[model samples]
Target: MATQNARKQDPQEALIDDLRDVLADTEAMIDDVTAQGGEKALALRGKIADNLRAVRSRLYDAEQKVAGKAKEAARATDTYVHDHPWQSVGVAAGVGFLLGLLVSRR
Candidate 1:
C-alpha cells in the first residue's frame, strides 16, 4: 500500500525535466552574452534565433510522430478488442489471476 502510494519518476518525465533545465540554462547564457556588443551581437542573436526555430520545428515533428504511433496502437487495440471480446476478457482474467497470485505470495 505504501509502495503503491509513492510517487514514481518516469524516465520520459525525467528526460523532459532535464531538457527544460538545459534550455533554460542556455537561454540565460545567451542573454548574458548578447548584452555587451553591437553588430556581432546582433548577428549572433539572429543565428541563435534561427537555430532555435529549427530545433522547435524538429521537436514538433517528433512529437507528432510519437502521437501518431500511439494513436495507431490504440486503434489496433480497439479493433482487436472489438473482434474478440471473449478472448480479451479471458486473457485479462488470466493476467489478473497471475498478478494476484504473485502479490499474495509477496
Candidate 2:
C-alpha cells in the first residue's frame, strides 16, 4: 500500500523533483564558482542550460504526439459516421427516446 501510494503520486511530482535537483545542483555550482573564480562556473552554467533545453524538447515532442493522436482519432470517428449516417442517426434517436421515456415516467 505504501509503494502504491508512492507510485500513484501526481505525475508532475516527478518533474518537480527533477527540477528541484537541477536547481540544487545549479545553486551549488554557483557557490563553488563564486569561491573559485571563472572557468569551472562557466562550464557548469553551460551544462545546466543544455539539460534544460533537452527537457523542453522532450516536452514539446510529447505534446505534439498527443495532439496528433487526438486529431487522428477525431478524423477516424468523422469518417465512420459519414460512412454510416443512417445507422448513427437511428442509434442516437433510439437512445434519446429511451431517456425521454424514462424521464417522463419519473
Best by TM-score: 1
**Candidate 2: global Cα-lDDT?**
0.72
- Residue-wise C-alpha lDDT for candidate 1, range 19-69, written one tens digit per residue: 555566767766976887788877887787777667666656655666687
Question: What are the per-residue Cα lDDT tens digits for candidate 2 across 33-54?
Answer: 6677688767876776677678
The stretch of ten residues in a row with the least summed lDDT in candidate 1 is 2-11
Per-residue error (Å), model 2, residue 9: 14
For model 2, how many clashes? Answer: 0
TM-score of candidate 1 against the unseen true structure? 0.72
lDDT of each: 0.72, 0.72
Error of 1 at 79 (Å): 0.6
